[model samples]
Structures are given as structure tokens and as C-alpha cells.
Target: MTEKPRMDVHDLVSEIYARDSRRVFSTLVRLLGDFDLAEEALHEAFAVAVEQWQHYGVPDNPRAWLVSTGRFKAIDALRRRVHSQDVREQVSKRLDELSQVNAERAAREIEDDRLRLVFTCCHPALSSEAQVAMTLREVCGLSTEQIAVAFLSAPATIAQRIVRAKSKIRDAKIPFDVPSVQEFPQRLESVLSVIYLVFNEGYSASSGESLTRADLSSEAIRLGRLVMELLPDPEVLGLLALMLLHESRRAARATPEGDIVLLEDQDRRRWNRTQIQEGKELVERALASRRFGVYTIQAAISAVHADAPGTAATDWGQIVALYDILLRSAPSPVVELNRAVAVAMRDGPAAGLSLVDNILERGDLAGYHLAHAARADLCRRLGRTTDAQAAYERALELAQQEPERRFLKKRLAEVV
Candidate 1:
């Protein structure tokens, strides 16, 4: 047998940062009882790991090591600060409790810390807008830029919202406990939206070398299952079904080398029938309830595509109807862009181009790359080469993900 390659300590730490930084941060929040303090401790622990791990070698349990180190760092910081008599005594008491809690793992949080953290961030104390921004920024590890893209707002605005949310949590001393079962309904919408946005980031990474991040999408699906099990509501079922149906296409979504395979171009034989069937069943149940939301309607649209054996067989008319319903329910520029694409399939390029132009003229999705890419495709189909080239160029400029950028370049080249 060949010898196993030795991994660099730095690379290992970086990999762990990508995978478990948020996880460790969540646990640290539980241990230290403050988001800002926990965040600082997390970075300090990782920095120390880089220098120390080289000499000590990789620990058998890196996460545990990081957590322990973070806790020590926080305690040291607290010790360094001078406080009033009452404040000092309170700090001493809290530190004693922290040490006791660390020794007794059974006393610690039994629930998934991320789940608890998400619910905590979604507390009614924060506004709905702040809740989404805070969870996406803190819990999901999304950049403020990514959160802004999801919200179609300015990055600075999203950043301020997150800052304000964290300050409120700290000032109010919000209990980070997982919300009770009854409180799930009140916070369910915000939680579901955040999960789906996480799924979106994974399904189509907003930026990065890879087109998809399987870990993020898988976690989103897992959360969806947990939510459905606890809530068993129509919208929850609908959201889960929507993710499953989209995930079912993952295998056929890209080439082995990681180039994107557009939905119409992807090979149907590679689709996961099991997920498709399960998603379709859930969608049916959710639709039957008539209480399903936009997610259910979107899943119904995906079900229409799943039933088709090929792109040509896809019932675009039915999809357009679903889009119409979805637009009425949600009414976002993104939804309108999607519906315009569907209308192109049902009618002709000219018809879809007209709708897209109307949307653009209204100053909606002006900065969204996908909107330009869709416009490019429609223009290309209509033999409007100049318009296609300009649209493709705009998309290429705005696109971040490498695979998508490559695809745009290829389309731009074709027109040139």
C-alpha cells in the first residue's frame, strides 16, 4: 500500500475553520454567555492553534481543544479587566459556574447549539428584519454581503442591522435558550427563510471556487427535517419538499470537473428519484392543506419539472401558472425574474424579453447577476446578438462564483 500523505497543520486548521468555526463559536457563546466575547475568543483560539499545533501536532479532538482554549481566553480576559466590587464578584461567580458547567457536560446544552442559537437570534426582541440578518450573519456564517444579496438591501444596511441586533441581545441579556414548542410558530417564518437562504448559498454558492457547498445544503435539509418533525405544519412541509426537490437534482447539476450544467441541459438519468418522489409526496400533502405558502407553490413548480423526462417535455404553462401564484404570494423581483424565464419557455423569447425589460425598467434587480444572465439567454435566443453580448458582459462583471463566471464568459464568447 502507498504511504498516506501528511497534511500540513495550517491546512488542517483552515479546513476546520471552514467547517466548524461557526459550530465552535456557538458552543463558546453557550459557555461564555456573550456573542461578541465568544467571537473574539474563537479567533484567539484559532490563532493560538496555528502556532502551537505545529509543535504539539494535531489534537485527536480539535473542536474540543478549540472550545477549551476559547473558554480559557475569555476567563483570562475577564480577569484582566478591573471592575467595581459588585461587578467583580459577579464575574467571579459566573466564572465559577462556567468551570462547573464545563466539568459537567450533562448540565450543558443537549440540543444542537446551532438550532438553539438560531432561535435565540430570532427572538421577538429583535425585529423581523434584524432577526434574519443576525441569524444569517452569525449562525449560518454568511458574509454581510451575502445576507444583503439575499435581502436585496445594501451591505452597510445589513451590517448595521446585525450590529444593532447583537447590541440589543447583549443589552437585554436575552436568554439564549431554545424557544419552547409553542413559540416555534411565532418565529417559524424567520427561521424557515434563513434556512432556505442557507440552502440557496449551498445550492448555488454566492461566491467561491466551488459551484456548490454540500455541507451547507445538507445541514439546511437536516434542519428542515428537524423543524418538520417538531412543527408538522404545511409551510414547514412545503419548505422541506422544496429543498428536497432541488437537492434531488444535485447529481446532474454539474460536470465531474465542476462546470455548471444548466437545468435544461442536465442529464435526467442522474436525478435522484427517491428524493424527487419524497418531495413530490410532501408537496401534494402541503397543497392539499391549502395552507401552504410560497415555498409550497415553488415546490409544486419543481414537481412539474421532476415529472418531465426531458426539458422539452416540461409543462411550462403549468409552471407559469405556479409562478403567477408564487408572485402573488411573495411578490419579489427575483420571483418576477423567474416567472419571466418560465414565460419564455411557454411563449417565445420576445414575450419573455418584454417582461424582463419591464422589470429592469422598473429598476428592480438592477445589480443581480442572474437577472442579467437570464436576459442574456433570452436575447441570445431571439438572435439579438448586440443585446445578448451586453447582457452577458454585465452578468460576467457581476458574477462571483467561478463556475458561473466561466459560463457567462463562454456565452459572451459565443456572441462575440
Candidate 2:
């Protein structure tokens, strides 16, 4: 047999690491019961894999192998720490007990580890920002640099936040299991918010050359599916449905040259039929439950768009109604801005423009680029060329993503 190329070995190992790193990390978190220690063990296991897998060839079960290796690494690190002998003995004893579990049981436990990790990261004890940062880093497998870029903050600041969040988790002794049914509803909202934040960043990146970060969006969808499977709450289902409905249009959300394509202009043929079908079904299920919340209403609105044959055929009135309901449940300037857009489609450009102007006068979303961009679009539609030009200029100055800036500049040229 021909010898396998060395570069192929490196590529294969990298692929394995990318694919199984989060799973391995989740399992290690369960075994170690300390976020920092589990993270250290996970990296150490991969380092060992680089040396061992190259010589011994890949393991049949890479996730299991990594988990076991990480456990051993954690035990070794514990022994090295200058703590009481009792502490060392306790960890050693736990490792010994874990080692005796049958492979079948261990595999089952590993399957549930990701869910536990999600709940732990979204614990109410942590602040909302910290919960989001921790979930993005630990569950979504994003680097601090990537998270910082998403947050528009320095990497050091993001790093410090993650460190503080992890330290809090350890110090607070947050349990590594799903919250009880009574405690779950309050906790679940935070978990869903973090997942949506991840998806939004992926669906329309805040700053970068590309408009979409498919990797981040896809990772969010994967986590959404995992959460839905583990806990079939109505809102959880709604959240997954909402993401799926939006993601179905990913292919058509931008032009080949990477310019933004407004939803009304996007090619319906490019939308993922399978995802739309699934999302619509999920929306129905959520709505029928009557226990559905904000996410379900948003999914219903997306369903309306998806069901329409074209923009002219869209049920804008229904969308506006849904937005009204959404606003009542989760009132925010952003939701109000979206509602204004829907109101424009339902009523007229003048109606939408009036709402946008009111929002601007209130000075709530004055610095928000999208608010300015929306105003510019409305101004252009109403033949207010000078106002449109100024608004576009403001949007261009505020926009950070290259694609968005390019889009704003293109709009500005048309008005000028």
C-alpha cells in the first residue's frame, strides 16, 4: 500500500479537531466540574492527539477518545496543583469511579453533556453579556478574537469577560445539569437569546468583508437543534423555527458580488425549500401550543413571507399585526423600527417614513446605522433626494462591515 502523505495527516487531524472539539469540551466540563480546568484539559487532549494520531492513525471513536484523554489530563493537572491532598484524592477517586462505567453508559452520558453545558453557561447567576460571551465561546466554539469582532470590542476585553465568567461559574458552583422544570422557563429565555445572538451575527455579520458567516450561523442552527431535542419547550421550538426560516434565504440574501439583496428583491428559487418547509411546520406546532412567545410570533411572520409567491403577494397586514404583538411582548427600539417597516409595506411609504422620523426625533436609535439606512431608503422612495443623500452618508459613516458600507455608498450615489 502507498504511504499516506504527511500533509494529509495534518489535514485530517485538523478536521477532527474542528468537528469534535466542542463535543470533547462538553464532556470534559461534565467530568472536571470546573470550566477553566475542563478547557485546559480539552486543549491538552488535542495536543496529545496531534502527536499520537499521527503515529497510531486516527481513533475509531474520536470523541470518546478525546473525552477519556481529557479526563486523564485533568487528573494529572489536579495532581500538579498545590492544593490539599484531600482535593487531589477526591478528583482521583472520581476519575477512578468514572473509569469503571461501561462504555454504553459513558456514551449515553456524553450525549447529554452538551445540553448540561448549555444550561450551565446560561445560568441566571451570570450577567446577560457574560452568558452570551460564555455560550459563544464554550458552546459555539468561537475564538475570543471572533467573539470580539462580533461584539465590536477589543480581544483583550472579550478575553477578560470570558475569564471572569468562567471564574464566576466555578466560584458559584453552578450545577452541571439541566435546570428543573420550575426553574427552566426563566433560564430558557436567556439560552435562546444567546443562540439567536449567535445566529444574527452569522446571518448578517456586524463587520467584515463578507456579509454572512455561514460557519457561525450553521453552528447556531446545530445548537438550536440540540436544544430542541433535549428540551421541547414551545419557545425553544419557536426559536429553532425562527432561525431556520431566516436561514432558508441565506443563499439569496446577497448577490454573487456580495451586495446586499433586499428581501423583496431576493430570488425565491434560491431559498432552501426543505428548511422553509420544516420551519413552517415548526411554526404551526408552536402556535398551536398557545404557550408560544416572541420567537413564535416572529416565526409566524417569516412563515407569512415564505408562503407568499412574491413580494407583491406578501401579506404585509398580517406581518404588521404580528409585529404589533411582538412589540407588546418585547418592546424595544429595534422592534419598533422593524414594525415601522412592516407598517410601511402595509400602509404606504409615507406611513413608514413618518414612523422612522418619529424614532429619529426621539433620538433612541440615532447612532444605529440600520435606522439611518432605513430612513435613507424611505427618503429615496418619496423623492426626497437631498435628505436621502444625507441619510445615506450618515449610514455609510456608521457602517463597519465592508459589504454594508459598499451597499450604502451605492445607495448614496443613486440619490446624489
Candidate 3:
């Protein structure tokens, strides 16, 4: 007869990491009363768990164990700082009190702490960029390197951003609970934008060795669901739909070797049917209410792409019409660039080239990588080798992502 080994220890550890991450973070936030300190405490506690869990066996309540460990670390860190004697004594007393607190009460307190931490990170007082970096680091549990990829910045730059954001949170005395209904819209919009940015970064990494970061995309999706649950709105549904549609194609967006695969060239058969179905459902629901935002419109465009059986079969005219609506709703250089691509598809490469050249003369997208790439593509289509070669070289010089740079270089070589 075989005995089932006690749940594999490594598996148990991983489960603990997942189930208790928020709890650990929340408890640390309360104990330290600072986002950066809380995060530092949480990691220190995890380090201890990795070392001690194997010897002690999994605790009956893994989250409670981690929370307790983090709280202790927070107190120790405070005590190490040579503050006023009264401050030191107060912290010592608090540590003693924490040791005596009941585990059940601590767990309940941790929930409230997490809610407070969320509101604080998403505070309207902070700039949108700061709010995003802070919330992702504090609420979504992303490391600086992961956030850097998401923000399209160097890791050091991201670290500085997070540091400055936390300092602002502390200095501004940002409230730690949800704002009143009157204040909710502004705060929530900031929060939602951050989540969407996270999803976008993962969906199409601006620059990375890998084309995607599933962890970030999943985290953003989870955060979106949570946001919608807490405060359901038409815009929230629009964001959810947009993310679902984008994520559906993730499986087909890159080659086996991690090269970029343009949407038209992607293997539709490789798309996630379930995600596509769910996304379509959301888009339908959002559209039924007759409340279409930028996200909804973008999702609708993606839906068109998803529904088409092949590139040649695509409903380009409809897409061009939608882009017309989108431009009015949210006029940006990037949106204009995308509109140019759609126009090229519906008309001809020459028409698209005219629009792109007009834009270049305006010098609005001079530093934009996609503009150069788009021009190169249009020139290639028109069989203008000299123009194509120069455009590809320009794109290669401006391209940030390694894979995209490779793509541009390949195009240039072919032209040469």
C-alpha cells in the first residue's frame, strides 16, 4: 500500500506565497505605517519563510504566519532606527502589543489594512505616474524590474519613481480608505488607468527579451476584475473587454523564437477561443448600454480583427469608420498613426504613405518608433526600395525593443 506524501513542501510553499501575499503586505503596511517599509518587511518575512518553513512544517494558517513574521520585522526595523527615546519606547510597546494580539483579530485587521493601502496608493494627491508605480508595487506586488518593463523605463529609473512616489504618499498624508462618492471618480480613473497601463505593457511590452509578461498581464486582469467588483461602471466594463480581447491574441502574437508577429500574419487558430468569447460578451454588454468610451471603441476594433478569418477577409472599411469615431473621441498622435495603418489597408500603400509623410512634415512623431516602422512598411508595399531602406534604417535606430529592432534590421537588409 502506498502512502501519499504530505503535500509536497515546495508546492505548499508556493501556495503560501500566493494565498498570503496580500495578507503579508497588508499586515506589514499597518505595522510599518509606510508603503516602502511595509514592502521591505514583507520580502524579509518571505525570505525567512523560505528558510524556516521547511524545518517547521507548514503552519495551520500560512497567511497568519507570514503576517506575524512581517509585523515582527517591521517593528525590528523601526527599533533599529535611532529615533527619540520616547519614539523608541513607543515602538517597543507596540511590538509587545503585537506579540499579544490574537491571530484571528490580526487576520481581520489585515483586510482593513489592505483596503487602506489600496486607497493610499491610488490617492489623487499623487501624480498619475506616481500613483501607477506605487499601486503596482504596493497593491499588485510587482518588483521594480517587472514594473520597469511595464513602464518602459530602466530599472534604476523605476526604482527612483517608486521611491519618490512613496515619499510623496507619506509627505502628502494621503488617506488610506476609499474616497467619498463625490471624490471617487477622479481617484478611480487614476487607478483604472494604472491597471490598463499594466495590462498594455504586458500585452505588448515596449521593450524586453520576452515579448510578453504573463505575470503582469494576469495581475492587471485580476486588478481590473477587483476594481469592477468594487465599483462597476461602463468604463470599467470597457477596460475589461479591451484587456480580454488583447489577451486573447497573446498566444498567437509571437513566433516560437520570440520574434514579433504582426496581427495580420498571426495564426488565428492559435488564439484563445475562450478569452475571445468572453471578450465579445463584454463588448456586447458594454455596447448595449450605448456608452462607448475609448476602451470600448478600441475593443470593438479588436473584435473586428478577431472575427475576420484572414487578413484578406478583414472588414477594413468598417475598421476605418470606427477609427474615425475613435479619433474624435481620443485624438492622439498614436491614434492617428494607427488610423494611418487602417487607411493604408483600406485604400493603398500610396495613400497611407501620403498621410504618413504629411505627419512627418508636421514633426509630431519624429521620435516615435512605430511611425518609422509604419513608413518603412508602406514603402516596402509600394516597391520603393530606396525609401523603404531609409525608413527601415530610421526605425532600426529608434526601435527600443530588441525584437522590433531585429525586425527593422531584417527589413533594411532585405531592401539593401
Candidate 4:
């Protein structure tokens, strides 16, 4: 008889680790009540799994196995810290109590651990950059190097930020529980911003061969849904809606060969109508509440695009008007760049080029490749081949993603 191909035990462990690591980590944090201890215990448990699962085959309940092992690991570490028998006995007693409580409350408590963990990482005491770094590292399970690349910072800098953030949480005694209703509004904004940042990175990876990091985007959306379920805030709904609306077009965002297909060129037929419809409904709800914020406005803008049958059929005037509102609400150079594109659609390429130049003159986006790429497209349309070629070359130098680099190179070839 022919033998079936044997799966590599290491690969099997890796797959299980990838799928269950977050869940197991959440439970560990809850049990240990210390980030540093929980992280250590979690890794130790996984290491033990690598050794044991090879001989025993994978556990029927991998997450449970990891969590139990992590809990014991934490107890062992605590025992080692205190040489006194009395202290060890006290620690053992506490562990017994915790284990019993966990057994009784595991299902419900584990479900909420992630939400609580998110709130703790996004505590206002931490700087915005630190909060984002911590969330990406702890909650999203991204490595420091990956977080650094996503945000265009050095890995050491990102590592320092995460370490400092964790130290602050410990020093300040930040509670690892959801904020009260009174403090929810302020804290929710930070949480939403982190989630949106994650989604944006996933939607358009900073540097890579692939145009999209679907896993990151999907994780962000999942977190958004969890936030909405727990809080149900208008802004949270809007945030989720915005993500869904953008994700609905993900199917058509790039060519089969992974080159970017501009919004005007994407095949609209491939858009996920279900997500668009849900996003539109959420946008309407947020708008009706009149308590909506930046996310809702962005979702409203995306809703307009999703409603259009084609690029020409899009409501450019409304889009430009929405951009005007967005600019007034949350002003940024990136917003201005997008508004310029809308203005171009509404007015003319010359008008857009003029705004792009103004942004460049201010040095607001001097190193941003998209800014130069937009200028190149406008220059090409206006028959200024020399200027277009220079802009494209600059954009190509600044571009990090392989697909974007290819596209810029192609544009430069045309102008040359």
C-alpha cells in the first residue's frame, strides 16, 4: 500500500501557533495580570508545545493546552522568584483560586480579554505613537520590525516606543479593563485611530511585493466589529463602515499581475456589493446621529464612490464638498492631497496641479511618493513630458512597494 505523505511536525505546530497564539495570549494575560509575565509564559508554553506535540501529535484543544501550560509556567516562574516556602505556598494558593475561577469563567472572560487589552494599550497616558506601536505589537501580534516598516521608522525606535509604553502601563498602574462610559468617548477615538491605521497598512502595504496585506486589514475589521459589539458608538459604526466600503473594492484594486488599477480603471463589477450596502447603512445611521466624526465623514465619501456605476458617473461635486468637510474637521497634508484629486475630478488637471504644487512648496509631503506620482500624472495629461518624466523618476525613487515601483517606472518610460 502507498503511504500517505506525512506532514511536518514543525509545520503543524506553526499552523496551530499562528491560529491560536492570540487567543492563548489573551487568556494568559488575564490569568497572570502582568504583560511581561504573560508574554514570557506564552512563549514558554509554545516552546513546550514544539517539544511535546511532535511526539504526541497536536492537541485536540490546542488553545486550551497552551493556556493551561502558560498558567503553570507563570506559577513556576513565581515559585522561582521566592525562595521562602511560605511565599511559595501563598502563590500556590492564589494560583489554585485563579485556576478555579478561570475554569468557571473562561468562555465569557476570554471573549472580552482582547477588548480590554486594546483599551489598556490605547490608554491616553501613552503618546499616540507609543499607543499605535503597542497595539500593533501586543494586540495585533506584529513584530517590532514589521511595525517599524509599516510606519516608516527604524526597528529600534519602534522597539523603544513599545518598551516605554509597557513600562508606563506598569508604572501608572493602568487597569486592564474597558473604560467607563464617562471616559469611553476620549479613549474610543484613540482605539479607533489605531484600528484605522492597521487597516490602512493592510489596505496599502508600505513596502512589499504585494499591494495588499489582507491579514492585517481583516484583523482590523474584526477588531472594529468587536468594538462595535461592545460599545456600539456612532463613530465605531462609522469606522467599520468605512473599512467595509474600502474593502468591498479590494477585489478590483489590482490587476491579476498585482499592478495597481487606479480607481478610474478598476472593474466595478467585481466590487463586493454586500459590504458596500452594509457600509452605506452604517454611514446613514452615523449621519443621523449627528454625533459622527472623521470616520463617518470618510465613510460617507466612500459610500458616494460605491454608489457610482462608473468613474464618470461619480458625483465629483459631492465628493469635493465632502473633502471640504473632512479638511475642516481633520486637516492633514494627506487629506489635502486627496481633496486635490477630488478637485481635479471636479475642475481640471491644471487646478489639481496647482494645489499639488502648493503642497510641495510647503514641504508638507516632500518625500511622499503619491504626491509626486499625482503630479506626474497631471503633468503627463498636460503634455509636459519633461516635467512628468522628472516627477515620475522622483516618485519611483520614493516608492517602496514593488508593484507601485513598476507602475511608476512604466509611467516614466511613457514620458521619456
Colliding pairs, model 2 = none
Residue-level lDDT tens digits of model 2 in 17-116: 8877887888888777788898899999889977877777777777787888888888788778838888778867877876775433366577688889
- Tell me the whole-model lDDT of each prediction, alpha carbons only: 0.84, 0.86, 0.79, 0.86
Off by over 4 Å in 3: 1-17, 23-33, 36-116, 124-132, 143-164
Q: Is candidate 2 or candidate 3 better by TM-score?
A: 2
Q: Cα lDDT for residue 285, model 4?
A: 94
Native-vs-model 2 lDDT? 0.86
Off by over 4 Å in 1: 1-118, 124-170, 176-186
lDDT of 1 by residue, 1-416 (tens): 12223458778889999878987888888888888888889999999988878776777668878888988999998887747988799799989889886622431342366667877887878887787677767776778887676545699999889888888888888888776788766677778887787688779877777878776687689768866764678999999999999999999999988899999999999999999999999999999998889889999999999999887889999999999999888899999999999999989889999999999889878889999999999999999999999999999988888999888998899998
Q: What is residue 109's positional error in candidate 3, in angstroms?
A: 10
User: What's each prediction's TM-score?
Assistant: 0.66, 0.80, 0.76, 0.75
TM-score of 4: 0.75
* Most TM-score-accurate candidate: 2
